[model samples]
Target: MEQPFRVCIFCIRTFIHRVLEPPDDVKKLFQDYSQNGTMSMDGLLKFLSKVQGQNNAKEDDAEVIFNSLKHLNIFPRKGLNLEAFYRYLLGDLNTPLSPRVHQDMTAPLAHYFMYTGHNSYLTGNQFSSKSSVRPIKKALQNGVRVIELDLWPARNIKSVVLHGGNNDVEVRHGGTLTTSVKLLKCLRAIKEFAFQVSEYPVVITFEDHLTADLQEKVAKMVTKTFGGMLYRPEIDGLEKLSPESLKKKILISTKPPREYLETQNSNSPHKSEKTSEEQGG
Candidate 1:
């Protein structure tokens, strides 16, 4: 038998108290550097260096450290606010405590850990399961930033989302299957629950296998459902957008046009080579 993991409420409460109400020495240190409720960058560097036991720290070393802190949004352009400085020292400055900082947005896209959900519309196993919009609602409420939508064309209906298999396009686990959920219902649920948890953007990864007419319907549904919240390169232009810029927006990640894919392949260094052996020759 397996034992369930449990959280220690007493430990959590004690930690929260320590964070919310810092020790006297920590408060005294903040007071020492604070001037008119703010501390200059130079003063902050001096304090940090001293705390790290780097006595008589060089100017270059201090500047490097300051740059890193600025990246974390710990220091403002001129100085640091008293409360913000305290939060930084206590290490509760990002996300659940506050909005993501500029540094968090400006980092390379590959660096961030995207909270993702696979087959988001399924309530149970894929083989035999009931499809429902509730899973999307719950996942978004829990701060999932990326969701997968598998689209297929239906006979009587337009388009629906489900895990594909030898069986019909319905929600199912290994062998068990459930009724299919409409694509529109899932989209509406996504729109409703997206910003409830976090102001961050939501990405929908579409696995589309639909007829041309059904594909058009899917496009129309997305436009109608998301409206102004949709991220369109035509409207915003083809510039590198940061996470901060995309807050409260819904972005769709799907297969690119054939021409676009061809262009990308043409640009590859080994485009003409058939294989590693050909390239070497």
Candidate 2:
């Protein structure tokens, strides 16, 4: 049931009592919860009041907010949403209008990837088929939620798992037309191989060279062959896709500059960007 005027009045009275005389333990609990990203607006208000009363000497509200946020697991990992918090602190709550409480900062776990033509591990030794599965296995073992793959398919018929050109195969096979191999074998190999290492679901992200049906086919294959491990669809021009499409299990493999992200958050209707092969597949 909706809260009526009497309910609002009761809530207002409760809030007044809370602000005027909050308990000592409330501050500690508020600090704990705020650090964990579990703090509510009521908790924050109580905590701020406690801090103000304790210090009679004024403190920077920004510092207090940052200290509270430092407790979250995402802090020092992903960039902080400072602007939204700043607005909240400065905005007039009793005015005709107010900004949102806090812009959503929740994000899925992500892993960085860089593709190489040759299967050389970071140790500079050629990877055996046994060793070839090591990097992927490690990612799975560490509970990596996403795996980015780079592709350069001339025709959408075969999705080549490559970020850039492969000259090693050409040199070995000795022909101009004999370019990189285009087959599902490598992708299938990762799936079959990772299953041996971990049971947790893995989301495979693909970066293709602007093909039409390739994304659809890959999406089908991901659902059919790999138990829906695909995390991205139509790797290029993600800004063009509708909002609903962007919100599914799929994510566009684009990491724009911090400035771009801030600008988009402030002005643009879209949040994703056009990814370069340099950022990872």
Candidate 3:
């Protein structure tokens, strides 16, 4: 018999009961935490803090419990202490503010984590309009804090979710083709889907791959659709452009390296333009 799927409410975690077993220690800790009604949230935090500092438990085991508690709202929502707790749990010391093993007790984790839906999907044509919606909805349903979409310019330079294209049977046409959805349609669909899921503060990030003209149009469309809800990451070439310009236009991926882009003079005419200019001169 096949196992049933179960979705956990607290952390928006999900699993197939048949295929996976819960970690015994983690299960015991959670059961104990729930049974200890007298234990305050602060006490729980302190316990985890101490456990994290001791470095006795394997890092992987500790992280599973920490994330589980996070979904259960057992930890502080935000603060310096929570930040340190996250760093300790992740075993990350890349930042300058790494928690001190002995003296530091504060550092609060950020309240949210962002993820994309298509990560685990095995479908080759996963970028299509229909195929993409399932993961997007799943992410929203599972409390994915933020979502990123790769937008490519299609016919008429219209933006749509997908980076590149080829032939495939699962797609609308028999074989692989280009994206058929428009930027506006995608935005509206996302807004409606997110609203239905009751996931507020949806962060929609756009990874734009388009020409200058198309970028401007896509940016305007997003701004009109979501107002300030849309997010565009800082690209390398864009630093020279004013913030206002960026806000008004869709941001492309990190621009070509400054050295390469600068070396090619914009004033040089194209073959056609050069021929015309030379003939006129």
**Best-fitting candidate, measured by TM-score?**
1
Residue pairs clashing, model 2: none
Overall local distance difference test of candidate 3 = 0.43
Overall lDDT per candidate, in order of appearance: 0.69, 0.39, 0.43
Number of clashes recorded per candidate: 15, 0, 16
Error of 3 at 38 (Å): 29
lDDT of 2: 0.39
Cα displacement (angstroms), candidate 3, residue 221, comes to: 0.3
Best-performing candidate as measured by lDDT: 1
lDDT of 1: 0.69
Give a tens-digit lDDT track for model 2, residues 1-281: 12224455346322221113334564445445365434544444554566434223234543455465565433343323333233334434223442222323232232223222232111123321222334544554554535555444343223334543221111111112223333244355456644443333344554443234544555455455554444444565434443223332433342333444566576644323333333566
Worst 10 residues of 3 by lDDT: 166-175
Each prediction's TM-score versus the true structure: 0.50, 0.27, 0.34
- In model 1, state the lDDT of residue 157: 32
Q: Over the stretch 1-281, how does candidate 1's per-residue lDDT look in tens digits?
A: 12234457543322212325567886788778767767776777678567644566676754554455675433666666655566666553222432334456754345577899998988887766778899989999999999988776443332322533212232222223455677777888999999997887899988766555556767877899899999887664535576777889999988854444677798777865656567698
Query: By TM-score, highest first, what's the ranking?
Result: 1, 3, 2
Distance from true location, Cα of 188 in model 2, Å: 1.2
